[model samples]
Target: MFDVIIIGAGVSGVSCALILGSAKERPYALNKKIGIITHQKASSLQTAVFNNAYGIPAGKLGSELLEESLAHLSSTYPQVEQIEKEKVISIEDDKTFYKIITNKNVFESKIVVVAIGAGNPMTIEGLEDFVVPHQKVPAIKNRIQLKNNDHLVKDGLYVAGVLAGHRSQLSIAAGSGAAVATDILSLWNDGNHTMVHDAINK
Candidate 1:
């Protein structure tokens, strides 16, 4: 069983998993097994341009970011499993954790982050049979509305990137990933975690 299962290989999903994978001192990094399930490659990363992706100058290829990020993840978290070319059918709550059933395999995890791009929504038959119909869908604003300061769409279910409404932009999507990761860390730490700030103390 994994500690976390991210259902996308896009920037948001990768960013979230990267943070946890690199946090060596944190429980998630040290003890958790993280999984990323995706069909083919991240479509956004393949075709996206960095126009609005803050800090990144225009004209840079999105594929570059994808390659660099994947390289870093592999090096930093060698154990991170990437399940490619598989489409997720549904996510079921198993009381203690979540069961992510895909076309080719099944995964169990304590937490789930749905970061799939908004442009392509998965068509799962009878998804209602497993998870509650809580996640929002295709329409721009229909994306899941996360609870303030937390990424919990519902209990163990979390969301990032376009799934949470920030679509098409890489920077915002990555930022959303970081936000969810921070919240997940807080939850895992029994809500005892504190946010960091670089601003000078008054």
Candidate 2:
């Protein structure tokens, strides 16, 4: 079983994976297994341009940013498995672990983060209860989000990114992902707050 399985490969999901799989003093430092499941399609893929995202060069294509992020995650954290081309269908709570069912395969993990964007309505079986009208981005009437407390849906379950009711902004989504990872790390550290940072070797 994986230590953490993140659903969705958008900015939020990838950012979470990056932190969980980083080579610093944290999850990766502890050799935790991280997995990401996605169908390779994120709302950012359709974005024409990204000029408002922080730290990103102006006039960059949203797709370019996502591609670069994925590439960095893959190359930097080779141990973090990217379960590509798979669409998560449902998530089953199995007491001590979660059974994530996808169109291609089934995965089990100790923790799960749902960062699927709010571009479409959530259809997962056990997660529909948390679905609520998105407070932001009113232009998209069909968009919906999941109710969460600082990205925590319950023990071992979390919601991030747009699905967590955050604005549909790249920086916000990425930050949310990192926040969730930090929370998970804290749990692993016996409730002590944990932070991951890297500095140049001098």
Candidate 3:
């Protein structure tokens, strides 16, 4: 079984996977196998024209930034498995690892991060009202809310990114993703993991 599974290929999901798989003295140091599933490119960012994220010059297209980030991620993390072109059909807890059924394969992971963006509404039992508030527009709704500390969701499930109500900005989404990854790492360390401001410092 994989150690962590991040479901989304957006900035947030990418950042989370990078942190979990590339950190020098954390998740990667412990040899965790991370799997990232995406049906297409990282996110709508590939086509976004935004130019407001930190250090990403005012005129730099979101697509360019995403490309650079992805290239870096690939060169730096060899243990991160990218399951591209596969959409996750369903996720269920089997009393241990999560059973994630995708269009192409089924994966089991000790930890699951649902970083699915808020671009589409996801219907779930009891979350009907929360999924799609403005049915007319049908595009903007908070995906899911996590308990405090973003933990203990069925003993392993975690949520991050726009779906978790974080700002849609690439930088903020990336930060949220890293935060959730840290939380997951902490849990794996038996609550002994301390947050590092940045990987360079640690």
Clashes of each: 0, 0, 1
Supply the global lDDT for candidate 1.
0.70
Better of 1 and 2 by TM-score: 2
**Candidate 2, residues 1-202: lDDT per residue as tens digits?**
9989999888899999998887344543477888998666645455668788888899988778667878998899878899988988999999899999998788999999998888666767789878888878685466788888889988899999988998877899899999999898888888888887887993
RMSD of each predicted structure? 4.8, 1.9, 4.1
> Model 3: how far is 197 from its true place, Å?
7.0
Clashing pairs in 2: none
Model 3: residues >4 Å from true position, as ranges?
24-29, 123-153, 196-202
**Tens-digit lDDT track for model 1 on 1-202?**
8888988877888888787665646653467678888563546577666766677788877778777777778897777787778988878888899888898888899989987765433444323322322244445443333332245677788878865755446777898898888787777777877343334784
Instruction: Tell me, by TM-score, which candidate is best.
Output: 2
- TM-score, per-candidate, Cα-based: 0.77, 0.92, 0.80
What ranking emerges by lDDT with the best candidate at the front? 2, 1, 3
- Candidate 2, which segments miss by more than 4 Å at Cα? 23-29
Worst 10 residues of 1 by lDDT: 125-134
Q: To one decimal, what is the Cα RMSD in angstroms of model 1 from the true structure?
A: 4.8
